[model samples]
Target chain A: MAGIIMEIVQKGWPISRIKKFIYLGFLLVAAIFTVLYIVKTNPINYVSDKLPFTLGNEKPRFLFSIYGSGMNGGLSKPMDVTFVNDRIYITDTGNKRVQIFDRSGNSVGLFGKAGNKAGEFKFPYGITGDSEGLIYVSDMRNANISVFDRAGSFVKILADNKQLNKPGGLYISENRLYVSDIAESKVKVFDLNGKKLLEIGKAGRGKEELNSPNSVSVEGNRVYISDSGNDRVQVFDTEGKYINTLGFENNSKTSMFVNPRGIGVSGGRVFVASKVTSYVFALDQNGQKIFTLGGMGQEDENLALPNGMFIDEEGRIYIVDSANQRLVVYQN
Target chain B: MKLTRLSLILTLSLALVMAISTAAFAAQAIDSGPVKGDGRSDYAATPKNTTTTYPGGIYLEYDANGVAKDIHSNYQRNTDACASCHATHTAVGASLLQWANVTDTCNACHDGTITTTYDVVYGDFANGTRTYGGLFGGTTEGPNSLSKHNVGEVNIAAAPGGNSAGKADGFGSEWGKSFECSSCHTPHGQGRNFRILHPDVNGLATINRVKGETLTSPDNLVFSSLKAPWLYGRPYNSSNFSDSTHTAVYVNGVKQLTGFSIDYKTGKVTFTSPPTGTVTAWYVPSFKVTGDVANKLTANEKVTYKEGFNEFCGACHTDYAALTRGDGKRLTGVYQEAYRHAFGFNYSSGPNKKGLVFSNNAAKSMTNEFTCMTCHVAHGADQTWWTDWKTKSGWEGIVSGENAGSSALKRLPNMATCESCHEKGKGDYTY
Candidate 1:
């Protein structure tokens, strides 16, 4: 209620008659605002004051993060990290290698050096090791998905189907591999032997279309895709039929996402990592948002430009904080 | 005493000469407007002037000596329109924009429907507000409306072999970011124009940037000379084709539009033609704002409507703004709007649809002319233009392989981007 006029009056500088009139006007305005504020009881909200740790339904503690020691565990703009069996495979994208780690965050070894050869990589981005420990690394620059065996040995380059272009995100399940190419703006499905099965969608804003799809995750008969360019997360059937969406449109006091790029499924929860908003949105399997987490900051709990992530059996979430050049872990 | 008298006489004579020259210069600057010689005389044109151009909503304040200063030119004064949208302390988001970004802030007012306009509700501009109204008559900015400009920034850096070094840092520090309102508008009152177009900040001002820089900008895409009008603002067809005759026809399609052989930076135009053996491109420069006599700005007004709108946009899209074809070698001496995309066309009398088609220049100036906002959204438009393909059923589907690469696909029904408004059917687009 008391604004600039009140401050002027408190200063007590009776500079002129106009100042007196202004003070009187301020007092009248203040009285009106005071009554209005009482009636409304609506408090003004400050955005920066919102805590990073205060988002989402399930509060996950900021467990120790791995910034990489520039040795065995070194990372340069790591894109995605996935946990298979007892080992973790991280797409060290900028370094052009996949760094394997243990559940305790210690480095096991790394595979696939930087090159354009069959066993090598060109800007390796997404990494997902299947249940059989058959590792799949999508080379964004090379436009090919390379498969590796359980011991970090190169199995073969996916040449049976040469349709990959700017392969950014990958998700594999039921002997099928799903590749989301950012540049091509589509999700491609292929068999474990690298034969083309079905192409999912193309660049568009429509229900069946996608734009700059960054990550794809599968659970049962449903596949959740991060429609980054469209600012929403779309759900598709295992056969790639369009099934509703969950994102900025469904945003409310409970859940919302902006540039939802990294998508992961754990149990029945769908976790969305938004690069621009720097928030990880958590939703139920039915596309209903449960809680939200993280805010734009460099703090322990805060996330900056989270790209790819995975959830372990124990409900621990590992986020590839791309811009921060670190792997952040959060456990409920 | 004799020597003193001589010195006095000499001084009086010099003073008289100086006074006469100063008066002549001022007259040359003020009198020769469009009213005098088709907006190209000792002055340039009428519309290019700020006094009548800025109309009412300009942000300017005069000093004690009556010199006008743009409000946002100095932040310490706090006189500009910054607080109109942006709040420094209580702001959120990466840009510290009033809301999330320019799109949200602009949509607050221009969304057309105004139960709660920013000027009326949240802003200090307690006056009437203008709407950036959706081309299709929506109240909200409708960024998500049909197909709107994409303002969201992607975290991916520009890869190698891309068409550009990279797009400007649109969102925050990251280059290749998507649209920001700042990409076009300065937000704060700046330059000599009201739109706050940053590259061509120096509008018709003559003290500096006289003949507008002809070379391309350091950014490599835009040309600097695009800041001001070198010829008249209206369309002049300079083709080998013909239509109606002119008052005096020099070229077939074009009239004797006397912009050739003038220097707008120097505020001079020539009516003289080449001699029997003279070799000259006959490039005369005139302007719309400087040519107006009655609207001579009193130091505090913004440039008028359609004055430098094309030139300002041409600052970024240099090739589109070229008056010449073949790499600046040929002098078409006009904007050449026949085969290429057109801007500044008079559309006051056409089918006045709001968005999907030609409508009233709703958010544009009162001149009823079409500028960049007519077809494009400032923040960014839908990427459907880049990805949509025609299916065998004539509907949109995910195009693949050879068709996407080798074949030209038909446009299908989508949100109101260029296609929805252009036309329907294969190659039958009216637009």
Candidate 2:
């Protein structure tokens, strides 16, 4: 075997040396590739990319969602939706009531009827819940905000100032309740009782102002409001500090929104429903679109005149498909 | 700049290569700083740092500074021994010791019998290797001698005692997950706790078991069930009356040991200056309020409570309290003494007998009976005891180092400390 191998090598074949050189070449190339890969895929780069989508930017566009709409017996023409214990409570405007449904779309209960009474509603719009599960509803047309127990019993009428003119939206946290009156283009804060504490956002077409503000959301100290007339979402603090504007168009060249309405916040993402373009866009707090669930047009996800919207804990979108005569749900 | 970068890289690479290859060329144990006597330090305790040299070459190396270096011995009592086979820096498994794989880091070097005249082999430690010699004494049948570690058997049911719910003889059950070096041995100097505090096991159970924001009925009920025993009034003594029932509650048969006031409402078990040596009882915080709520407990309190009760103890042991207490109710809140061991078995009765029987209702306290810690280490143990709980010393009491021969004394300082009272087993248990 040695003689045969020597004969082959004598024919000028450097097999062992060539194999060793190839192995060395492979190791060198693999090392270089691994270093390059590590440098390119550094986690710092991912973090930097994600930074722009938070409260770091000027125009922080939030996502929009719709909850319950009329045409279904349980809820019709939902003007507002709030979530509690994996359940969504919709202010069913057309049914003149508030409807509750499990996260799975099963109807649980309903409150109110077509009446002008205290517990009853003419057009209920904004709805919210507190830590104790007490729900507060804005009876928009009736010009009063009503509070209800978790079991839907009418607790009391809260913050019924006639100054709550055309109250478009309502939001409540553990401490305060915010009421947005579209006609006044102002958000009014009040105690649980009918006591006005502070009023925010005056009617204005300029930046850092509200133009027919329709919806309100409060997460910690930051307050987000939808400016329908200006086609933007404005940020403010409880002290009414104008933090920033979300989805504000610098130029008309880029179609931002025709009529931005209805706002909801969940899992660090914000939802905004646009009536004019009939699209719902999801944005981080900094107003960058993470993904668009639906838009205007004849597609499976397309919404016809998507109006009021809300989001649940699981990041599912509930949209008021007003033109479609259905309550549509977009699941993550 | 480019040349400087290249030089620095080259220098680091060369230094690492040298440090890995030749211990003599290792950088000065300087940053380790002149050896201190503690295990963590590199200083030599010997004068002149020189012992009599052996005929064979001493396995010693010098750092790059040329300071004569002392070889590192297995400082950790739980770590496997080097020099059993290979030279220094040549052991295969983690911690630079002789283990075959990540799982064998503890068992590979200790994979065989360490039995001599005094120390006895218990259970098996190797494949097809059953316990050969007797345990403590070769009096009865020797324990199952098989290597329970490095088991690549994918099926948990296939391993010895794998299907047996309470049997923890050797590495009998599937490790379920392969033992990565990080799994049991934190090479980065993690604590000598079980499996190097894997991210999943470190505090996940506590974090996930936090109490809900809204205390639901079922959750609060479970929390209350764990607290009820502490809230129940202990036997109180009244010297003013001198009842025999109250006399038993004395600290030393003179001073009253109960009821200046027992406030279940305050949830604190504090002992005032009213008496000395009086044992005040408190529930383990986790048992009362879930791990999350337990964090909210006040520091002024005492009397730590625990999770397992007499029934949890009765599940495996042949204690009369456990059997009689168990009326087929699984999460039973009551602890009836009369029927304690009626459900389990009595193993100490006959010769090599193995069957569930009524408890003897022995004089010892139920807590003194077989507890969970008796056989199983609740927190993770060394990979050897972890892999083979039955066979290893320091496990179930017998360990290496300061205490070797007797299970009565353990080397790991805190052997079966939690288990001496929390023993859990019945029937003449064999690996």
lDDT scores of the candidates, listed in order: 0.51, 0.45
TM-score of each: 0.42, 0.35
RMSD of 1: 29.8
lDDT string, candidate 1, B345-417, tens digits: 5555533223322223323444555554444433322222222212122233333222222121112223223
lDDT of 2 by residue, A215-307 (tens): 788765788888765667889988898888776333222224545667766545677776545556656756655444444333456565555
* Model 1 lDDT per residue over A265-309, tens place: 654567898665566767665566566566545578766557798
lDDT of candidate 2 over B14-113, digit per residue (tens): 5687678676324323222211211111122222223432111112222222111211211221111122222245556433433333322222112121
- Weakest 10 consecutive residues of candidate 1 chain B by summed lDDT: B37-46
